[model samples]
Target: MKNISWIGIYPALLTPFTENDEIDYPLFQINLDAQIEAGVDGIIIGGSLGEASTITAEEKREFLKYCVKTLEGKKTPVIINVAEQSTKVAIAMALEAEELGADGIMLLPPLKYKADDDEVVTYFKAVAAATKLPILIYNNPVDYGIRVTLAMFEELLPYANVQAVKESTRDLANITNMLNKFGDRFKILGGVDTISLESLMLGSHGLVAGLVDAFPRETVAMYKLVKAKRYDEAVAIYRWFMPLLELDIHPKLVQYIKLAATAEGIGSEHVRAPRLPLKGAERERVLKIINDAIANRVALPDYKNL
Candidate 1:
């Protein structure tokens, strides 16, 4: 119900699974605290990076409760992803998230089914009407195959709770178009992990970053530097970060990111089934990339301390 500002590096926190593929609540709590402690602006509880598709409804609700409880009295607002297949299910999740005391919800137009534009628009509006929680419109057509265009935004015009958008269109022009067309009506959070610097350089409001899961402080440091108008410094950090950030857009992003996060000591290299752990040549290659970064990790300058 409250207006939660959607900006800055929302890590899209990875869900830690146990050795037997159960939800590891304790490890999830540790990862959440590390991200909040590292100074991210907001926390998106269950997102694509969080492996929301594989996570059960009960797990989602429990995670939302965990976020609300752990981040109690904090400025960092916790938002959960509601990417259900049915409108009814999505609306139910939205209402439940609000009831469970989440700061906001991110809606990714009915997952799995390639719904038509009008159908997608209607689904988003219905969920918006079902709850008072502030909503972030996740427009990642690249992965979801339903790009929420400006026309869709026009249809969402009636909903005051449609406060922000996760722009993963992977096109810088879309950012300009959204800004020029809507003129700040919707806050824009860069969704693609690889192009975060480009997004901020072109004036995006902030980022819903994937790389932040592994390198929380480094991600936050880049955000702080960019916002402070230190473009050169920000670019330097981005240059060093791009190799790992690009992992977020890959096919095995779940496995890759979990490995990276584990390397940082915040989570386990565990993923729910249907998705498996990286192995053999694929495993060795990914580990080398992650290990190299770990060895020469950026000494993020004072952003956390200051």
Candidate 2:
């Protein structure tokens, strides 16, 4: 039992927007309040779920500042994603997040070019040197084209700030291998919703779930059950929520999530340019699935304008 104690449910929150595509600070506060009511242990701001790439740097800073202000007196921690294309940018963002009173920072590997092990280690070391707060390494190979191998992690773990890793790779064998090797040194969090239960069983500390944006209560219940050593109950809830989680893997994930949230009155389905809302049969299908889930009393958030 090392000091790595990140467990339970953490929502990879969506960046709420107005119909005009501006960041809705009010709606964002509403969403955060809802997550707190649902009992989530923490919230992830400006990750993939937050549409970080579409958000400008200034908006990112504002969002972190607001989250810090809003969550100041609460027990729920806020982890700000400091991912950028360059190491210097990442370092700058991490320092800014730390200054904003963020509890921790999550980072992605440098996205421009594929770096060797030494380069990757150096990148993280530089980021670690910039912040005294905890750092969660986000290993999203699909998006960044860089895979952080275990050897690379071994080299980077010497930096005292690198405390956690969000393993988003699709390879379960690699996940199991990492759990076997460095489970003590790092708090491993599951990034994929479908494999979350498996990840927990395999020694992951918890999940930073995208689906939790829609079904926070159910996700929180699942986490509590798993943490209580109640796998059978946890698997039952997972199976029930499997359809909703499957929707996240679609290419139109941002669109689908926004559509689902809109249907549930949590937020609008307004994605930024280069990503549009779900329309035609795709939109209809998503609506039907979410509607049916609600009709079946699947522990949904309050849905309006059905």
Highest-scoring model, lDDT: 1
Q: Which stretches of candidate 1 lie over 4 Å from their true place?
A: 304-306
Residue 26 displacement (Å), model 2 = 1.8
Candidate 2 per-residue lDDT, tens place, 115-225, comes to: 877888899999898788788898878767788889989987678778888888867776778878886788888888888888888778888888778777778777777
> Measured by C-alpha RMSD in angstroms, how accurate is candidate 2?
4.2
Instruction: Give per-residue CA lDDT, model 1, range 1-306, as digits (tens).
Output: 686767678878898999988889889878877887888888897787788878888888887887788888989888998888899988888888888998898889887899999999999989999999999999988887999999999989889999999999998899999998898889999999888988988878899988788888889999988888877878888888877987998999989999898988888988988888988999889889889877777667787544
RMSD of each: 1.4, 4.2
- TM-score per candidate: 0.96, 0.92
Model 2 compared with the native: what TM-score? 0.92
Clashing pairs in 2: none
Whole-model lDDT values for every prediction: 0.87, 0.80
Error of 1 at 81 (Å): 0.8
